[model samples]
Target chain A: MTYVVALDVGGTSMKGGLVTRTGEVTVLAGRPTGRENGPEAVVEAVRAYVGEIAGLGRSRYAGPPAGVGLAVPGIVTSATAVYSANIGWRDVPAEAFVPSGVPVRLGHDVRTGGLAESVFGAGRGVADFLFLPIGTGIAGAVVLRGEPYGGARGWGGEIGHAPVWPAGEKCACGQIGCLETYASASALARRFTARSGRTATAKEVVELAVAGDAAAAGVFGEAIEALAIALASYVLLLDPALIVLGGGLSEAGAALLDPLRERLAGRLTFQEPPPLRPAALGTRAGMLGAALLGWQAAGEHDVGADWPIDVLRGGSVS
Target chain B: MTYVVALDVGGTSMKGGLVTRTGEVTVLAGRPTGRENGPEAVVEAVRAYVGEIAGLGRSRYAGPPAGVGLAVPGIVTSATAVYSANIGWRDVPAEAFVPSGVPVRLGHDVRTGGLAESVFGAGRGVADFLFLPIGTGIAGAVVLRGEPYGGARGWGGEIGHAPVWPAGEKCACGQIGCLETYASASALARRFTARSGRTATAKEVVELAVAGDAAAAGVFGEAIEALAIALASYVLLLDPALIVLGGGLSEAGAALLDPLRERLAGRLTFQEPPPLRPAALGTRAGMLGAALLGWQAAGEHDVGADWPIDVLRGGSVS
Candidate 1:
């Protein structure tokens, strides 16, 4: 069937699988990223992980995949320049991480996840959507016409650093009042700890909020309000058909969605806010998006011609 | 010698010119928009402007030129539904303003201006640049690879409405602390008047600041500081190669760019500070942009197929 391999390279872990054309992923594997040693070590680790995935694919499918796609965190200049704060790698050329002529495609991890959800998962058929993953930090990927929007120099869907609480908290990025400080899982945990004078993980706070604990409820409600503010601005600017929520906090489900929907409804009047929905594939989305990029890499010289609009629409511009 | 009629619609007036492929404008004239009477009046004004331009072109050019390119202020949804607060327009089908069978290309005014600048003006040869017109309200146009980034819904450059002050004065758009309320020329006048207890136009304020008037300098400094904050966020997000200041505020020349550059330098690192330059053309940018669009409307059918990359690089996804 000539399947492809997809990988998500994170600061602490690498997760990926062999994906078929139908969006099915097999040969799943997880391993430590060991990125603290810097760019060279990170490159070697990614090569080794991709090799292991290739081995699994050959052993199980009895055929080598057409190509490989890899997703990574932080600012991605192109397949040529990968600078990541999470992984501590600066300007690592993407083609250097893979074996020669294996046909590797590189993309921003969140954007790739957004592509996966927009194409094969929850955001299917929606023309515009914001994929916001509220985890240890909050970052977003914007999808338009089923393709992720990478702005000038590939920095469009950067909603996390979009400045949430201008006077609220100081971020490690040296900015004041970033959204991640309020809406991320870490934000939830911090708010709970600040209010209750007791340390608790985000998961614990979620449980307490569900159980109707006043302090936890207050913190959770505050977090939802912050999310609403950020998403409301996004709505006015992008006017997406829907918004997909992902990451660790999204697992709380309706507890997050209902309040968010209410807050968004209160603020908007003229804009057709995208319907709210859950991300379909979970953490595996990055891998799937990378796989899609792989498919593109293998088919780059085909009918599409790698034209920008074709790259954006997978067909033509509207 | 083929030419097309171009109509540049603004909140208060409609300007028209016969534009050639070589970027020449002839027989320019303008009439009051009188849009308060609603869509019908606006359409009539537009029709009259187009008629004059068409007459001028027919009398001068030999071949049957293409259709018209009309630029208007508002959130344009396709060739229909133009939403403008000043003009009091909503869901007004733009094609209704044109003669039947005339290929009319409708575009947001700022985006159209951006197109002109990118192709024929100061931004020429720059792969990426952002155009911020500091008029009564501030808005931006993202130009990449010789085109404007018109988001999925044609609203990519809404930098004015992007939040700058967390607890700032309420905006008519129902948002608080938008960049428009601080950095625009109108904002400078308002802030200076309130601060100095003496009413002054934005230009006068700049003059006073240059003359070392403390009160004027303080208020002008505030406006520059606000621009710095907004541009910092912009640089982090889009990372355009250059930023061109346009419109009335930009007319102040070094008065606007010099301080804003210093403030921005103080804020960002790791990202190269793009050289800030003044927009070469004056208010004529809109008219020139409209003409450019008309010239392209003559050839857009061929270009549409390849427009997405330019769009994405321009902000196709928002």
Candidate 2:
């Protein structure tokens, strides 16, 4: 068995762990990703975290790493970080940041997470699936034959940018009517905050909607409608076998998925509706995806990779 | 040199040809693919055409066939013929119709056309490309790495059905506001006829638009705007290297591509606009894709098998 190092860098935090081919993760390590000083500083944090994790794993394990896979958020150029809309970085070299000889692989975080789900999570046994994370941002991962279909530049699966409504709401990307403006976690809070003049988490908004609050319910329905609109467009293009919703809004589970599923069904003209399910691994999907990719790079599975509990860090399509 | 046979079937015509691996066509044969009598009539048409073409090729050349590829319009399931909206086909047993002794393959017409373009036509050497056929209908083909990416159920690249206006026009598929209503050859004729109270062909409308006719120019500009909108959405998803417009509208050449390029470029926000080119082969793409698939099935090329062609032909994806 060989150990695989996995890193999942997010907008707010950096998560790392040593994982095995079986999806077991240990020697978990994390630190603030430190986006305040800009993207280069985040790179430093990543480097430091990876060094410590690799050192710990080496002291505890019996074999060298099989490979490493890192997941990052942004417009990736064939898994190479090109720009992060949230991280404020331009053309960050992912493989270059890691020390030589590690054989690092980089992919969009959502793509990796969706890959994890396709292999081990909710998407197991499904040949075609879409993992859409409705959180602070709305993005998707298209999994085909257990692999994510990363577009030419690896910036594929950016469904949020797909223009649906003409001249509706302005997006930060300078476009109008982005699904993110209506369906993301930030959208939920913003919608409620705009009406009630009080900011509440997406979770709180869901609770309010469930307790017979008409305004919150209306906003919730709008979010569901937006999701239905966005997903219907995707269904027209790619009829995925399953759709697994992840990230913050997904935490509401049936409260969100059930309505969204019905709304999507109502919107379909001819194609069959894909199954909607909750993401099983939640945030850990990133770690599992990294480990899974590392194993893929190694070309085989290694159970011993899990035993090195102390290992450090890490890292689409429609 | 091994000879490859390609077949493209439209609502009214069936186009077939023998092409070399270098994308050269030696023999071109065609017949009216009459579907009024249902799927069986179409199958008979295909078998008779293939027999005549393949027999003549064998008589003329000592080399064995590389492969055979077939393309059709409609909703293909896992590369198998399901229900075709344009041809009025349902559950057609395409594979049983092909001659059993040799390799044959099937695919969506536009996608296979895209395959032909990517391998031997305008999309050669393009890393990512979308082939849009603006004919009786406006469907598309997506090529990545010189191979078409057929989505789930072999319906991937159905750009025509993409919703353009929610409450605009009711399509035959029971949907409101499809891209097909604006950008297709039929759309141009319909728009012109609606404005002038006289039935006219798209070619005549284009000619009028070229000669500074106000009404014709308005319809032509509308078509260009709709094409720009749909293609812009496609760019957000895959960001392909090029957009190759095929079919009858492509006959307009620079008049269609130049203005469409300008309008699409003007609408971009986060994406870098891709160049637009006219499809090289007007109607022989399906035959070449069929031939490519046949060659692949014959173990000539390691390219994987596509599903829809499986029913019309025999081959395996490597």
Candidate 3:
């Protein structure tokens, strides 16, 4: 069976996978992006990881992989990694990340994750929705008409930076009242510590809030309110069919969904709120989406649509 | 030259025109919608107006009009008027508004104006932008990839009702701090009268503000700030290449555009603010867009691209 090498490159680490045409997956141990060593080193590390993954695929499937796909941070097109402030890269071609003679494709990291959700996870069968992953930093994949739309210049879906209070706290992005300032996973932890002078992870904070800790509850409450306001704006502006929540914070599950649903409904007077669902693919979304891009690079544009979700979720790991 | 019957249906008035395939236009005097008479009468009024314009087209060209296109208020599809709270209509088929056997098309009023801007006015050649008309109320036409988007259920582009201040003023829509509560033309007039204890039109309030009246300046300043906040949220979420401002308040010209540009820039910390320009079509955008839709119904989907801007602006009126 022919397979492809897929990589999801993040600010700190890279997850690699090998997938066959029918959705069988073998996930490899992740590697550090080594961005601290400089952009060129990071690029070299990616190439090396891809080469190693391809080597494994060749031994198992008895041939070179069909194609390669990498989901990279920052402004990306299918042909190039335009820019990534975190990775300190500029205009890196997709070819540089794969072996010579192999067709390769690239996608924006968050949008690729969103694409996975759209094709095989929570957003499956839904045409228009927002794929929002509330991680350390918040961004969204505006999936419209069955594809992620990155507006005029590929800087679209910066929903976290959109103001919630308009005149409230200053964000690290220098914008005032940005939703990320109160609602992102990093913000949850930071604000919780700032309020009570006790440090805790975002997950811990959520648990504390659920257990009725007043400081955690206050911080968590603000996050939910800020999220409600931002989501209300999103619903009014885009009127999506669904909102799929992902990333580290969504692990709070019903704790996040139940309150956010009620608050969002309260904010919107005239329209019904779209149902919110948790992301199904978890951290593997970017890598699986990369596999789809890999198949696209291999001229198999329709490959991922029929991939069984059970096989994708039940895949073996090494 | 063959022509089409085009009508723009508003709450209180209907504007009709006969537009030739080669872009020649004859605009007729508008008639009151007379909604006080009820919904059936409104539909009858529209059909009679369409018959009148088709008669004008036949007399002018010695043949039946090619098609009829109407831009109506509320939820609309190309083939049906789904619902209009203002017009109090439900599921009115396109054929009911025009002569039988003459192909007909319908469009949402604000989005139709945006289509005109996209095809022949300010948004010409721009692939993505927001066409916002701040008239009696505020709504937006989200023009993306050269077409207007109505989101999942044709309830999109309600930017006016998107909250600008989460805890601020109570809006008539039962939402808190909607953009319309502070920035709509009606809001300006009402807020000015409320603050100064003197009734004045929105235009007079603008003039007074420009001429150094403290109450007028305060009211206008708040409107601009509210607009800036709403627009900043739009920019962050959509990242459009440009923003086209239309409707009654936009007539303030530099008085509105200049301060708004400055404030919008200030709100954005990273991305460059898109250039804000006035809508080129003014009050006639809806009627002109209906002309394009009329052409589309005639299966001439590409007729508007070559229409001269000067000719559209200088169309004869009776």
Can you list each candidate's DockQ? Answer: 0.31, 0.46, 0.86
State in Å the error of residue B116, model 1.
Answer: 1.1
- Clash list (residue pairs), candidate 3: none
For candidate 1, write residues B1-318 as lDDT tens digits.
777777778888877766555444563647789877886787777877676667656776864458788888878843764688778778777578776667677778887777666765668778678888888888788775556766666656777776667567776678677777777888888988888899899899999999998988998887887788777766755567889889898988988888898887765644656889887666767776766666566775322222221221111100
Q: Comparing to the true complex, what docking class would candidate 2 get?
A: acceptable
Instruction: Give stretches of model 1 more than 4 Å off.
Output: A88-95, A210-214, A265-270, A300-318, B62-65, B81-85, B88-95, B99-101, B144-146, B300-318
lDDT for each residue of candidate 3 in A171-194, tens digit (9 for 90 to 100): 999889999999999999999999
Q: Say which docking band candidate 3 falls in.
A: high
lDDT of 1 by residue, A239-265 (tens): 577889999999999988988899877
Please give the TM-score that candidate 3 achieves against the real structure: 0.98
For model 1, what share of native contacts is present?
A: 0.28
TM-score of each: 0.87, 0.87, 0.98
* Residue A201 accuracy (lDDT) in model 3: 97
Task: Choose 2 or 3, whichever is better by lDDT.
Answer: 3
Clash count per candidate: 7, 25, 0
lDDT of 1 at B3: 70
The best candidate by TM-score is 3
